[model samples]
Target: MAPRRYCRARLGGQSRWFLDRGDHLLDLQSAVDGDDVPALLRHLADTDVTWAPPGGAVQVDPARVEWQVPVPRPGKVICLGLNYAAHAAEGGNAPPEYPALFLRAATSLIAHDAPLIRPRASDRLDFEAELAVVIGRRARHLDAAQALSAVAGYACFNDGTLRDYQRRTSQWTVGKNFDGTGAFGPWLVPAADLPPGATGLSIESRLNGQVMQRDNTGHMMVSVTQALVLLSEVFTLEPGDVIAMGTPAGVGYARTPPVFMKAGDRIEVEIEGLGVLANTVEDET
Candidate 1:
């Protein structure tokens, strides 16, 4: 088989990167003309290259550009709920006997630097900084040991929620899938470099330089591998699919006075090794 080549658009303006199937770096402009993505990925799988080209025609200053999600389209965006113990306690509950799960439809997908729009339908939008796993291969009924092997990489994710509706109903779907609600990326650091096997880790959320939610992944009721295996038992996860491990304690809705998002507010979600996801809230016109 040829090496698998994964094309990635970098955060800097006009700069792009590609990771071949073997995870080796490839030339940035090799994809400038926009090659057939899937086909390139297939070819990259069998070959190995260690270094990328030194320069390109377009130069970009990092400070002036906006970031975008790593993948433009994904087959599925799987989300976990109450997976963190402290978060469950904050919500006035015990760790679920099983991992609580949910799905955020594709429409909710947005990039890292994009504005998080205040959903017109709800005003209680909230932020959840989480460790997200991106699947690299088709998986189903995999044992816990095999779960991590199926992961493509890791990235930061903000599981934005519409609080009023989330609390108003038992099903969390409606409140979770509003436009610009799921902000993930700027990059997909391959699984090899990221801590694997669902071990302990930390995740945090901040607003205007103030830390709001800070918790460790070690407290997750179900480890990342466990969540992957459990979800795989039911649904087939494909490459590029994402899973938001879960948020920690201290969500705005769980606060004493409840601190919800308002227009003109800036939020950032950071995870141990994944990187940071930042967005500014803006009124939905």
Candidate 2:
């Protein structure tokens, strides 16, 4: 049997684990408690018994479930800025020796298919397609050689940005932290089932079915292993922590005539082997 993907969904007003079994969804929480990465992997490895849904019926249609960000409240949401050389050149920046890191608040995140709220304070709502890495084990001061081992899985992410605010100052905190700007998830693919470090995968973004940005994961200035190694040097990475690898060239603000998302536009970030993360834009009410 193929390895199962996992997602968090809101059903009956409670958050629970939903297993992606290809043709149908299974209530994973019915089979195990605590959907943390390590625990989930252990449960799968220790048992050969087929997991059945509660009462032997599919609890909810995946399309109908209210998707929640895979890691609803990650301890740390680290983002890499201008980590792609082509993106850097477009932005008129030179490649840096170290990753340009920034932190995002939990409140900035929205789930797959959820609306990305464009704040009235800014009209430059830009889309950045990125590959998100979810850490499973505690890691500190690790080298690149051991970095991949610390990861649990990978997911699709949209690093929605308020460009005007981002350039208001050298610090990008305010612009990147606007509520409901980060769209993550849909589901998480376990690392064991994917190519190591998810390298060479095609990553792209589309606005209302029109391709806006596209690149391969192999182009990142800092690979997953290197990013993990550098990050752990600063602080201990705990389970559920997320690292959003930087976007590639072709982001809205870098184009000759910039393209920004507005109300009613559907934006999608797709990564090969990971899956597509889709969200619609909504004006802040």
Flag regions of model 1 displaced more than 4 Å.
1-15, 18-27, 31-59, 64-66
Q: What is the C-alpha RMSD of each candidate to the true structure, in Å?
A: 5.1, 2.5
Please list the C-alpha lDDT of all candidates, in the order they appear. 0.73, 0.85
- Which 10 residues in a row give candidate 1 its minimum summed lDDT? 38-47
Separately for all candidates shown, the number of backbone clashes (residues 3 or more apart, or on different chains) is: 10, 0
- TM per candidate comes to 0.84, 0.92
Which numbered prediction scores highest in lDDT against the true structure? 2
**Per-residue lDDT for 168 in model 2?**
92
Q: TM-score of model 1 relative to the true fold?
A: 0.84
| lDDT (Cα, tens digit) per residue for candidate 2, span 78-107 | 999989999999999999887899999999
Worst 10 residues of 2 by lDDT: 41-50
Which pairs clash in the backbone of model 1? 2-45, 2-46, 3-44, 3-45, 3-46, 3-47, 4-21, 4-44, 4-45, 201-217
Question: What's the lDDT of the predicted structure labeled candidate 2?
Answer: 0.85
